[model samples]
Target chain A: MEFDLIERIRRHTEVNRDDVVEGIGDDAAIVAVPSGRELAIAVDTLVEGVHFPAGTAPADIGWKALAVNLSDLAAMGATPAWALLALTTPDGDEAFFDGLARGFAELATPYRLALVGGDTTRGPLTVTVAVHGFTAPGEALLRSGARVGDVVMVTGTLGDAAAGLRCLAEPDASAYAALVERLNRPTPRVSAGQALRGIATACIDVSDGLVADLGHICAASGVGADIDAEMLPRSSALLTHFADADALDFALAGGDDYELCFTVPADRAGEVGATLARLGCGAARVGRIVEDAGVRVFDARGNLYEPARAGWNHFAA
Target chain B: MEFDLIERIRRHTEVNRDDVVEGIGDDAAIVAVPSGRELAIAVDTLVEGVHFPAGTAPADIGWKALAVNLSDLAAMGATPAWALLALTTPDGDEAFFDGLARGFAELATPYRLALVGGDTTRGPLTVTVAVHGFTAPGEALLRSGARVGDVVMVTGTLGDAAAGLRCLAEPDASAYAALVERLNRPTPRVSAGQALRGIATACIDVSDGLVADLGHICAASGVGADIDAEMLPRSSALLTHFADADALDFALAGGDDYELCFTVPADRAGEVGATLARLGCGAARVGRIVEDAGVRVFDARGNLYEPARAGWNHFAA
Candidate 1:
C-alpha cells in the first residue's frame, strides 16, 4: 500500500539529473558530489502540532518541512541539490500525499533539487527532511568566523511569519492573508545565501528568535552584538497590521521566519547590501559585532530592550 | 533545554576526521566527500509502537536505529562514513539520552562515522537516521543487475529475529537470549558487502524477510526466482526453539532479520559461498533466478509451497 503512495510521489517529483546515478527504488541512493566541493548537509523534523499548528494544510506542512532544512543550507552558503524526506502519517489517504507531494515539488522544481530517497512509516504526522548541497572548500559561511569589528545584517524583512501565525486566530484572517502565507510558505534565501559565500563572515538562519540566534553566533565566535530596534526592517503589511512596539516584539523575539542573519566586515557591509539588493531579496544593516560576550538590544530611546519571550525552545515548559 | 541535550549528544559522538570540516552544533554540517568516489545515501524512520513494541529499552532503540541505516549502506556495497540523526521524544530525561548515546556510540565508534548534524524536537518517540557512505564509481551493487540463471544466496541465518520477537513474550525468554539479541542488535554486514562489490550480481539486506526482499531484486531485474524450502539456512537457536514448520514460516515470511540476500553467477556460486565463509558469515545457496516474473517456492516433495503471510508493508491494513 505504501509502495503505491511512493509511486505517486515519484510521478510528481520525477527529475532527470546527471549527478544522480540511482534514485528512489534502490537500497540506497547513489549520487556523485561535484568535484572539489565540500558537501553541506542538514536535517530537520517538523511535528504536527509543535512545528506547525494542528489542522494546518498538508501542502503547507510539506513546503515548510523542506523550507526549514533549505534554510539551514542557505545559512551555510550552499546550493541545494538533493533531499530525502521521511514522512510519518496517521492515515493512508492518497489526497494527503497528493497535496504533500505537489507542495514539495513546487518548491523543489525552482531549485532543481531532486528528492533522492526516503521512507514512509506509520506514526504521528512528522516530517523529517535531510538536504545535501555543495559549497566550495573553505567558502562555507561559519558561525564562528565573525570578528568583533564585523557588521550584523539580515536578508529580507523579519517578524512576518511570527505575525502570520498570530493572524491565523484573528476574526478577520482574510485581511492578513499575506502574513498567514508567510508563515505557511517561507521563501528560503537560497540564492541570496550563495551570493554571500565569499563576503559574509558569519551566517545563520533565524529559526529561533533574532536575539537567541544572534546569541549563538556571539557564543561561537567569542564576541558580542548590539542591535538597534528602530533599524529592523518591517514589511508594510506587518506595520499596517500592528502597532510599532508589537511589530518590534515579533521581529526581535518571535521565531519561525526563515531569514538569513549574517555578518560582514564593517567596510564590506555596503557592498553586501548592494549585492543582495540586485538579487532583489534586499538586506538590512541591523547591528554591529562588539567586544562583549552576549547579544544586546536597544530601543530608539537608547534603553535596553526586553521582549515578552526570549526564544523558541522545544523542551522548555 | 534542547540545545543542552544536543550538547550531551555532541560530547558522546565527537569524532575528528580530515574529511569533516565541521560537526554538530553548526547550522549545517560541512563534510568533504572523498574525491573520485560516489556517495550512497539512505534514510529510515522507526516509530515507537509501530516499528518496535512499546516498553523497549532506550539503548536498544538507539542501537537498532543506527543499525538499520548501516544495513542499507551494507546493501549498497558502500563504506559508511557520516550520519545525521533526528530524534523526537515525549520527555527530556538525562538517563534516556545517556543510554541512547552510549548504544549509538558503541556501534558508531568502529565505523568512525561522524555524527554531523541533526535536530531534536518534542513529539511522539521517533528516530530518523540518514546515513552517507562512499563507493567507487560503477561499483555499487544495484537491484537491477541480477540476471537469469544466477544463484540466489543469503548471508548468515534467517528466522532468528522473527523467532526472537516471539521469544520476547515467552515465559522462558531468558532461555532465548541469543534470539532476542538478534532482534535487538543485529549486526550490519558492512565488510561482507564491500567484499562482494565486484563479485555479486545484485544485493539487498533482508529487513523484510528472505522471500520479500529477494522479490525486490527479482522485480527490479525482471526475473523470477525458485527457492527450495528445505535448503533455507536455519540457526541452532531457531531450530531448537520451534518445530520445523514454524521455523520455516519465520525463515520465509517473518521480518526484521538484517541478513543479506544476494545473487551471483551460477558458475561461481560455490566460490561465493566459500568467500563468505572466510568472513565468518556463511552464505547458503537456496534458490536460483528463473525466466518467470514472480517468486515460487518448492517443498521437499516438489510440491508448490505456501506461507501463512507475505512480505511486510508499512501501510497494510
Candidate 2:
C-alpha cells in the first residue's frame, strides 16, 4: 500500500533533469550542483490544526505546505530546484493522497521542482517539506546585512491572509474570494528576491507578521526600524473586507502573510523599486532603518502605534 | 518559548565548518559544495506509536530518528555532512528536549554533521530528519547496478534489533543489554559504506526485512536473488534469546537493522569482505544474484522457504 502511494506521488511529480542522477526509489536522492553554485536548503513543518484550521481541504494543505518552504528559499534569493516531503496521515486515505499529489504538482510544475525523496508514516496529519535550491556563490541574501540608513520595503499587500482567517471563523462574514485565495495559496516572491540579490541589503519573508519579522532583521543587523503605519500597502480586498483599525492590527500582528520584507540603501531605493516593478511585484516603502534598538511605528498623525501581540508563536498556547 | 528551545538545541549541537556559509537561525542554510562533489539528500519520519513503542525514552527516539537518515546516506557511499530536524511534540517539555538533543548530538558529533536548519511545531510526537551528504561525482553506490553474477552480502549481524524489540515486550524476557541497545540506537555503517564505494556493485541500507529490501535491488537491476537460509548471520545475543527457527525468522524477516546489504562481483567478493573487515564491520555472504525476477530462500534441506510477512508496513494495521 505504501509503495502504491509512493508510485502515485512519483507519477504526479515526474521531473526530468540531467543533473538529477537519481530521484525517488533509491535510499537517497543524488543531484549535482554546478561548480559556482551553493546549495540553499530550508525545512518547515505544518501541523493539522496549528498551521491550518481543522477540516481544511487536503489540496490546500498540500499547496500551502510546499508554498511556505518555497517562500523561505525565495527569502534566501535561491532558485527552486528539489523538494522532499515527509507526510503523516492518521489513515491512508487514497482520495486524500490524490488531492495532495495534484495540489503539490500544481505549485511545483512552474518551478520545475523535483520531488526527490521523502517518507510517509501513520500519525496525526502533518506535512513537512524540505526545499533545496541554488544561488551563485556569495550572492544569497541574508538578514544580517541591513544598515542603519537603509529603507524598508515590502512586496504585494499584507493583512489579507490574516483577515481571511478571521472570515473563516465567522461564516456569516462577507466572503472575500481574493483574500481567501491569498490565505490558501500565497505567491512566493521568487523572482522579486532574485532581482534584489545584489540590490537589497537584507531580506526575510513575512511569515510571522510585519512587525515581528522586521524585528528579526533589526536584531540581526544591529539596527532598528521606524515604520509609517499609514504607508503599509493593503490590497483592495483587505480594505473592502476590514475596517481601518482592524485592518491595521491584522497587517501589523496577525501574521500568515508570505510577502518579502527587505531593505535597501536609501540611495538604491528607487532602483530597487523599479526592479521589483519590472519583475511584476511592485514594492511599497513603508519604513526606514533607525539607529535605535527596536521596532517603532507611527500613524499619519505622528502618534506612536503599539500592537497587542508581536507575532505568531508556535508554543505560546 | 520556541526561541528558548531553539537556543537549547543550538547549545547542544554546535558545528564549525568553513564551507557552511550560514547555519541555523536563517530562513535557509547555505553550504558550499566543492567543484567535484555531488549532494546526496534523504529524509525519514518517525511517529510516536508507529516507529517506537509508547513511553520509550525521548533520547532513544531522538537517536533512532537521526540514525535512520544517516544510514540512508551511508548506503549511497556518501560522507555525512549536515542535517535538518523537524520535531513535533504535544507540548514543549524541557527535559524531553534536553535528552533528545543529547542523544542526537551523541551520534552526530563523530560524523561532524552540522544541525543546519529545521522547524518545530505543536502536534503529536514526530521527528522528521533530512540529511545531506557529499560524494565525489559519479561515485555514489546505487541499487540499480547489481549484475546477474554478483554475490549478495550483509554487514554486521542481523535479527538482533528485532529480537531486542521482542524482549522489550516481554517483561520476564531476560534482559539482553546488547540486543536492547541495538533496538534503540542501531549504528549506521558509515565507514563500511565509504569503504565499499568502488567495490560493491550495489548497496541498500537494510531498513525493511532483508528479503524485501533485497527485492528492491533485484527489481531495479532486473535480477533475482537466491539465499542460503542457514548462512544468515545471527548475533550471539539473538541465538541465546530465541530458538533456532525463531532466530532464523527474525534474521531473515526482522527489520530495523541499519546494516548495509550490498552486492559484489563473485570474483571480487573476497576483496570487499576484507575491506569491510578492516573497517570493523565484517561482511557475510549468504546469497547470490540470478537472472530471474524475485527473491528465493533455500533452507538447509535445499527446499524453498517463505515468511508470513515480508517487512514492516506503515499502513498495514
Candidate 3:
C-alpha cells in the first residue's frame, strides 16, 4: 500500500538529463560537473522534538531543514551548488513532501543550488541535508588557525533565540518580540564568512552558545580565552526582558544564536573590522586568545567573573 | 542532558590529520583532498521501527545502517571516502552510541573511509548517514541510460532478504538460518558495481522489489520492461522455505534484495556476463527492456502474471 504511494510520488518527479549520469533508480545519484574545483560537502540533520519544538509549522520546519544545511556551507565560505535531501516521514504523505520540496525550492533557486538527488524512507520526522559546493582548492576557512593574542569577534547579537524561546514558554511576552523573529529566521552570515576567507585565523558558528562554541576553538587551537563581559553586545529588548546579569548570562551562554564567532590576529583585525564595517556589520573585541588553559571571564573593571553553567548542551540538563 | 554525552563520546575518537583538515569542533568539518575527482554523496536514514525491526541486535543494526549507504556508493560505482553520522538517542545507556560507532568504525577501516563529521542530538533513536565517495569524472553509473531493447540483468540471486524477513517474523523457525543472515547483513555488490562502471547502460539496486525498482528505471529511461520469471536466480534456502509460486512472487518483488539490477545493450550483454564472471560474480540476462509503456512479467510459456502489490511504502494500507 505504501509502495503504491511512493510509485506515484516518484512518477511526479522526473529525473532525466545527460548531465545526471544516474538518477533515482540507483543506490546513489550521480552527476557530472565541471572538473578542477574542490568539492565542499556538509551534512546536517533535524530531529523531531529536539531541533524544533513539537507541533512547529511544517513549512517552517521544511525551510529550516535546508536553511541550516545552507548555513554550514555559508560558514565554510562556500557557494552552495547541489544538495541531496534524505527525508524520513512518519507516514506517507505526498502533500507533506510536496510542501517540503516547495520550501526547499524557494531557497535553492536564489542560492543557485540544485536538488540533485536524495532518498525517502519511513521513519521519524528527520531531514538530513548533504550539500555539495565547488570552490578553488585550499580556500575553505577552518577552525584550527587561531593563535594566542588574537581578538575574538562575533557576527550578530546574541541571546535572541534564547529570549524567543522564553517568550514561547510564556505567551504575550511583548518584551522580546524582536528576539522571536531572530530565533525563527536566523540570517546566516554567508557574506561575512565568505569575506573572511584569508583574514580570520579561525571560525565557528555560535549555535551552541558564545562561550561553549568558543571553547571548541580554544580546544582545537590549543589556546585559552579571556572574554570581557562588558564588550559583549546586547539588544535593548533582551536587556529590558532580563536583569543586567541575566541578560549577560544569556548573551554569553545561550545556544542557538547561529551567529559567527571568529578569531582574527591583532595585525589583521583592523582590516577585517574595516571591511566588515563597510558591509554594515559590527564586530567587538569580545575576548582575546590567551596562552592559558581555560576560558576566563572579566568584568568592566577587569575583575574576575564566573558564569552559572558556562553553556547549554544538547544531551545535558 | 544529551550534549555532555556527545562531548564525552566525541573525545574517544581521534580524527586523523590526512582525512580531516579540521575535526569535530567546528560548525561544519573541513576536509581537504585531491582535486579532479567527482564526489559521490548519499544520505540514508534508519528509523526506530520502520527500517529495523524492534529489538534488533545493536551491532547488526549499526553494521546494516552503514552498509546500506555504502551500497548506494557501490551502486553509483564510487569509492567510499568519508561519512558523516547524525545520531539521535534516548537518554542514558552510553553503550548504545559506543556500540554503533564501533560497528561503523570497523567497516569504515577496511573500505578506507573515515568518519569525517556529524551532529549528535537527543531525540528518538535515529541514525542518518551522509556518505561521500570519489570517482573519476563521468565514471559513475546511472539508471536513466537504459535504452529500449537492452537486456535486463541482475548481479546475484534474489529474494533472500524477503525470505529472511519471513524467518524473522517466525524467529522460532529453524529451517532458514542463512536466509535470516542474508536479510540482516546484506553485502552490497561493490565489485560488480565498480567493474560495470562503463559497461552497464542503466542501473539500480533491488531495494524496492525487482518490479518496482525496475519501474523507476523504465519510467526514467522512457522505456518499459518484460521480465521472465523463470530466469530469476534464487537461493536454495528461499526455494526450500516457501512454495514455488510464493518464492517466485518474492523473487519478483522482494524489497531489501540490495543486488544490482541493470540494463545493457543487447550486443553488450555478452561483455557484461564475461565481466561479471571475471569478477567472480554472477550475472544473468533475465529479460529485455520493452517499447511498451509499463513493466510486464511473464512466465516461461509467456503467460502474464501480476504481483500482489508493488513493494513497501512508508504510508499505505
Identify the runs in model 2 with alpha carbons over 4 angstroms from their true place.
Answer: A172-174, A314-317, B1-3, B172-174, B314-317
In terms of lDDT, the poorest run of 10 residues in model 2 chain A is A308-317
Lowest-sum lDDT 10-residue window in model 3 chain B:
B6-15
What residue runs in model 3 are displaced by over 4 Å at the alpha carbon?
A: A1-27, A31-36, A173-175, A314-317, B1-25, B32-35, B171-175, B314-317
Q: For residues B1-317, what per-residue lDDT tens digits would candidate 2 score against the true structure?
A: 55467667767878787788898887899998877889999999988887777787888988999999999999999999999999999989899999888889889988998888878878899999999999997789999999998999999999888888878778664578788899889999999989989889999998877998899899989999999999898999999879998888888888889999999999998998888888888999989999999999999999999865677552241
Candidate 2, A1-317: lDDT as tens digits: 55567678778878887778889888999999877889999999989888888787888888999999999999999999999998999888888998888888889989999999878878899999999999998899999999988999999898888888778777664477788788878888998988889889999999988999999999999999999999999988889878998889878877778899999999998988888889887899999999998999899999999976678653241
Q: Please give the lDDT score at residue B173 for candidate 3.
A: 48
State the TM-score, rounded to 2 decimals, of chain A in model 1: 0.97
Q: What ranking emerges by DockQ with the best candidate at the front?
A: 1, 2, 3
Docking quality category of candidate 2 according to DockQ thresholds: high
* Model 1 lDDT on a 0 to 1 scale: 0.89
Judged by DockQ cut-offs, the docking class of candidate 3 is medium
Which of the two, 2 or 3, has more lDDT? 2
Index of the highest-lDDT prediction: 1
Number of colliding residue pairs in each model: 0, 0, 11
Candidate 3 accuracy as TM-score: 0.90
User: What's the TM-score of each model vs. the native?
Assistant: 0.98, 0.97, 0.90
